[model samples]
Target: MSSAPTPAPGTSTYRERLVPGPAGVAAVVLFAVMCGLVVLVSSTVAAAITSLTVLVVGLVLVAVTSPVVEVRGRELHAGRAHIPVDLLGETEVLDADGVRTALGPGYDPRSFACLRTWTKGAVTARVLDPADPTPSWLVSTRRPAALRAAIEAARGA
Candidate 1:
């Protein structure tokens, strides 16, 4: 894991940048190569165009799919949703089975999720307010325990 960022005074910050996994990378490459081959079989001009098109598509997919999780200034930012720490209850690390449950049967449509198929572990934050549509927040993380600790620190738990 990389070193976490330090926020200014009065804030405990934890930021993580999750990029495409090995499999994702492979998929992108395979797509480009396969498209190139298929086009090359037809015409060189079309193959060149296909190569460029595939490259752009691959980059866009990875860029849009990447998730950045951060906790700063009493707020938790996971993907696009931003929630105040005060509204959060207990936060914990989720293992493989726990992740499956949280993302599967236990999933909430309103919950904020930046899930990635490549990610194996996650961190869950319970919503304290029943009125809120979201029951909880499930965020994919490479370092679930560290993220939990960061949340605890933010909550002064």
Candidate 2:
């Protein structure tokens, strides 16, 4: 018996690029204005601290919402976090109901590691190991289904 031939390596079946939506842009702009106000109204030391904090936070937010999924070579990078090609498993696109189910209660936290709450949908990728520090990432994507398919295909699943 003969098996079907495999496609060329590093060839991706789907690809999607996600950027900040209107809400995210508004947030960045608002934060920037607030930082400027701090500089305008306070001492240089205070301004420096406020500006630094804002800058760091803004960068992180931008990073998180930068791109939901990228498939290149044999790897997949979701948002600011990177997931190895080999460890990836099944992929699913979550609609509103799916998001609620996957995230559970208090899904949106006010600070640190909080996935952007305003995303239209999410892509959940299965992980291989139980002890892996990189738990499944809930990525904010405008095109969640496409992103999930791309990730799954890239992983050769």
Candidate 3:
């Protein structure tokens, strides 16, 4: 993936929506088809309506539930949580192995992690606020390097 374009000072430097992949959509569609086929053995019209409704509802839920990651002004937003850029320590981009470890045995109980199995990379940042109980944040992303750069730039600004 390409790096996110740098925005003007105090503007959003990066933003991304973690939407469902094609495979996930396909799986939902396939399940709808299977349900339709089973119901078709009884009533064709009912089967068609049921499958259509299921497909529409399923896709809508998936889309609406997708998380957003953004770096705007002096803060970083991951899903519904936001933190000040200045309060973050060195941000590191992690590969698949590092992500696995961070999410596994190396994980800190006090850390906040927004993870998705589909996303391959992640960025980890230590929290600098001594009073806060949370030690760090682990954010899953498709573009870890871009996120790290955005956070670093925002911190500098």
Per-model clash counts, in order, read 0, 0, 0
Query: Cα deviation in Å at residue 41, candidate 1?
Result: 2.9
lDDT of 2 by residue, 1-157 (tens): 4342333566555455565667776777678667867686767777667766786788677866555466655666665656566776676778878877877774534211314566668777666766675556566666777776666556555
Query: Which ten-residue region of model 3 has the weakest summed lDDT?
Result: 1-10
Report how far off residue 8 is in candidate 1 (Å).
Answer: 3.5
| TM-score of every candidate | 0.80, 0.56, 0.88
Q: Select the stronger candidate by lDDT from 1 and 3.
A: 3
lDDT of 3 by residue, 19-96 (tens): 778888998898888888889988999899989988998899888898898999879999999999889999999999
Clashing pairs in 3: none
Using lDDT as the yardstick, the better of models 1 and 2 is 1
Name the best candidate (by TM-score).
Answer: 3
RMSD score of candidate 2 (Å) = 6.8
lDDT for position 122 in model 3: 93
lDDT of 2: 0.63
Query: Counting only residues 3 or more apart in sequence or on different chains, how many pairs clash (N, Cα, C under 3 Å) in candidate 1?
Result: 0
Locate the minimum summed-lDDT window of 10 residues in model 2.
106-115
- The order by descending TM-score is 3, 1, 2
Could you tell which candidate, 1 or 3, scores higher by TM-score? 3
Q: Rate the local accuracy (lDDT) of all candidates.
A: 0.80, 0.63, 0.88
